[model samples]
Target: MREIQTKSTSRVTAQATDIVLRQTDSIRLIFRPTIIDNVKNKEAALKGIFLYQKKSKKAAWEDFETIPLSSVKGGEGYKLEIKTAELLQLFQELTQLYELHQKEGVPRGQKRYVQATPQLEQLASLSDSDIHSFSNANVAVGTSLLSKLLVWATSLDDPSPLIERLVEINPDSLSKLNAALGMQSLKNALASWEENECISDEEFWQESLTKHSFVLEQVFSWPTSIVKGKAYVGGKNVFNQDGNIVDFLLRNRLTQSAALVEIKTPMAPLLGAKYRQTYNVSTELSGSIMQVLNYKHSLQEDFQSLTGRSGDLFDSLNPQCAVIVGNAGSELDDPAKKKAFELYRHQFPGLTVVTFDELFDKTRQLISLLESEPRVEVESDDMPF
Candidate 1:
């Protein structure tokens, strides 16, 4: 939830007319562009991302664009209640396959494929009536089964460990274990264990099946684009003595916010902004310092008319913050990466450029949180939705 305060001098581009949210299983994608191209002196590249969210005063499960990426912690904006009956049928079939593996010792190791078992064949051959019968008898059961199967299929990579353990515990009668009156204890155990456990922590499998990796597919910098210039034309004319008037008064989110932000990787043009006189005065990483300074200056001069309150828009007590974030590899012999921060330190003195390691771990946590709760659905009407 804590972020590098980002002070920007560019207006987000693209005034989207409407947006659509698309989903398949756990993945939700928003199909539209949100970024304003203030960089490169050209129009902003509007790209869309489908991600969960945990951000903001409104906390609306918005169309992703409603909140800043920096604020959308690992929070899935909202969860669509998945169907139950379909999930049940899938779960029953998967359980059968799992039981067969236990009885046959998982055929040594079945990371990808192995000979089909009778249980698997039976499950595959189930008639529509059979699946429907189970669903009709117990709607909850059906939904639970379907949900489990879907989660497992989409999430699991190797079921060897769960299979091997089951097989080891019950010799050839893995499927015919404890049956009380009409309940199956082994089945229940599998249900309780598999449904609640993390796929990565599944010890039944030899190793986790797949890997989840996130790439910084795209990123944008604040203020002047070497190509397009700043968001405001005739840059000087855009500001008054109060700094960033229209943007500050209009952007309550900007005037009353803070974060720890940076620019790294393919850092060529971005670093160019650090050479200005305003930035040269600081001992911190040049880029961030300059950005903050620019943000402050712009707001002070331009925002006065709108807010009718002048002086610093950012709270000096809690004014916006800026930090350089670069890859850990930046610390290596790479001259550009090392030199950027080195100059950063010489200029900013106590400024800290966060390493890629911290960036990665923190981002991963944020992503996970987003995928779950999503911090959507506004909590109050006072906060902008």
Candidate 2:
């Protein structure tokens, strides 16, 4: 299932080259710079981090290797609840890595207990020894390392309480044996955003839509309040017979054709060079509008075949748009790109568009506006199909 909260935009063009250029930040930062700087030696820290990661990943390999139905009998409900709980806990911790600090675990100021999300607490598969170690631990990654975590965690709203506990663990527990023994803190090793002495880094580089989506799944998959639906349907590999699905078909009613996202690193521009040229608001103006024209075309074809609707709602009517999301006072300044994007928008009316700031503003007030009313009523009993 997917979450309901999000921002939307229209589609654009791309190909194999686009795919190559489209590497998510998650894949780019092997180990956070902050973590590396504090680890004594870069190579050694990376090795340690990888080892920890590999340890936690055994669950995936084990689950994949084992065929559930054959291995377990009865208590399927309990078994499912157990596994889902584990995955959710893991996902929450992984997500905290993309927040403002970019490290892992919880940040300063917030309550530590929030880390114990329902899934984390419900995970009973953990071994007794591992549980003991987890309970009595104090994580001591360096300040730089914590800074990186802040960057990553900023991407998420609030991590689970267990994650907060992991971040506070001691360094000794991160060793090979300790990590393999179910060191949940290892997930934080995914990133270490260096809070370089440059205020520019914090000022300019804003998170993009793609980056937002990437962190969402990592941070929270099974929501606290479940959204009943058939499945999630975007980020590639999502298609339905009609642009429409049954009312309950989607876990999150807030689905879109495709969205374009851009990543900004506060001071990426001040560093000059390629970073300066690519990050300007004007430069990114077009980035949001044209994220997935190719995907839109593909969906159009599929939707047509499935629904056989009268008009070209599937083909000619591709309502994909762009969203220039990120921090405030961190907008694009380039003029040419802005002009081109403006021209494109004037030409396309159906395409929804906005910046991350704009999206945030709307989201905050939207809840009240929506609550004031309700979903549009459907008087006709007949289904569109």
Candidate 3:
């Protein structure tokens, strides 16, 4: 995904660690302080912890034991111990619960309940060996696994074990999960756009582009945030001024610089009829570029007044423009025509000329990265069970 420059001066913070495990005759698990600080409620984090075990590598996990953490000792790091056999049993139960949750669809919310069969008090016992093994798994996957456990625990009559584990989850884990889900949604949206049988009209393109301005930013490499759709370049409600509204207005989050955007339907032409046996920029393409430039000029002229009223949100100097129009269809089928289009696009310094197909291709490539890139992992010297 393209990186957008943020306005904030501080550096990005690292995600917090949740749980670390070590294995020997007994399994030892350590919970980081950040987890306890981020739970939905204090009770959920303070309750006794559950130990789930898997019978075999190939078998599912079943409920094993629940251990209260009130007696556990550590200021920043809390430790819990469980016999190896009991830990394995608990892991097996967790795996079974995870599988069942997956089949039923993970539930969302914070309702309290207790399980009838597992019987929270039946056993109060237990607790990794591959420190790097756990580290190798993607952070996104770990978060998903944790979420499944939460869902499974919540479904039972007594959710204390799972609820307690929730306290061990770092708040940053939720941020990672949200990002993963957002990327998945963008991929699905792009796939749906590709699968549509009929091409969208100009109005539809404009509306969709406004809603998904990130797609526009990706294609143009603008690296800015969308400030407003159908922005009034001539200043608020000044309809009498020429070029009163620009399709979109973008602002650099850090610099507060502005850019103007204009949209045209994908069916618009990339190349017109040959002139002197050579392809040239189609009228539609030229017109859109000129339109964006005109909007840029309008914004630049009104910059002082606009920024005065909005508080330095629009930079008067060095305003940029971009026009998203046309599709590289049959007209640009030949390599020569495609090269001509590229050369034409390069002629503009402050203005960018991009095709709808180019935007779609960029989005598709971004979606592909989600699968190709490995999930982010963190390494620690902490013991493994």
Candidate 4:
């Protein structure tokens, strides 16, 4: 290492060490720190920059081309210029050298950047092929990988090329990726449904809907009318100080028109004892529909006041109400029962009633539509594990 001295306007002198970060057959790169005192002038103080090859390999390595300091301290306004492939390699090597130094130079008191630092390091150790194998792994493992990636991505500076790749990923590619992920999520929801089919706990269903709000989006047959909304707007759908909570307070993302959702356990009956020629709607189902309607009316009456207080724009104009209850697959297996249930639900103006099974079945049909293209078959024996 060689020392370079520079004198400031105040006659204060600071020394910087010339450290060779990388060297090849015909090129060399050195990190020469000039000064570090940011009190007077940050630009002049931050003049420490990279020095590239400017002299013969055998000669004293004094002469070199200076790389802009902004390249190392990356930002949106900064541009890194690497003319030749050799210089690019040197830059990469220099970055790796600095990364190793950073790894060894952890500051006192700050234990780690993230909670799962060791897991992140282990995840970083995975090869391309090893990471590819994660496609077949469990959800927990996949979530872990995503968590680690999020930590790493957030740690990087803004305008990072790695994150910018998302821009190059066209809309069609994103749609396909989204469809694949949606298919997986729907499948998971189905499995969860099967597991909790016998469960009558209302909280379980509520929590499930909260965890997967996309499932509620499937409730809307007209997808174009509404965009996604938070599962629990105003935190648990509390629109007023009265502590009145709705299961979900959905809104048309474009129109801001509100919708109230009321949920009941899957075990809730869809129909009751036969009366006259048709079976009557179950007390539970009817009660839920009424509950959602009441919430809708309350929301409509308080819309302007709530909007003024919260400063959130929403319309309660002819608000829609929906009730999700019972397993239609089992209860509506009878043609007469199914028809009665459908007719009863349709009678209510501005109200929609959907069974738990029917809601997920809509999701299943959507996934089928997304994957309707002709598939190329690969023999099991030829398939790569």
In candidate 2, how many Å is residue 136 off? Answer: 32
- State the lDDT at 4 in candidate 1: 11
Sort every candidate by lDDT, greatest first: 4, 3, 1, 2
lDDT of each: 0.38, 0.34, 0.62, 0.67
* Runs in model 2 lying further than 4 Å from the true structure: 1-288, 304-317, 326-328, 332-347, 364-385
Residue 176 local lDDT, model 4? 89
Q: Model 1: number of clashes?
A: 63
Q: List where candidate 4 sits over 4 angstroms from the true fold.
A: 1-162, 165-176, 224-243, 309-312, 374-385
Highest lDDT model number: 4
Model 1 lDDT-worst window of ten: 209-218
Q: How large is the C-alpha RMSD of every model relative to the true structure?
A: 30.5, 27.1, 19.9, 15.8
Task: Choose the strongest candidate by TM-score.
Answer: 4
Report the lDDT of model 2 for residue 226.
17
- Listed in order, each prediction's TM-score against the native is 0.24, 0.24, 0.52, 0.57
The total of clashing pairs for model 4 equals 0
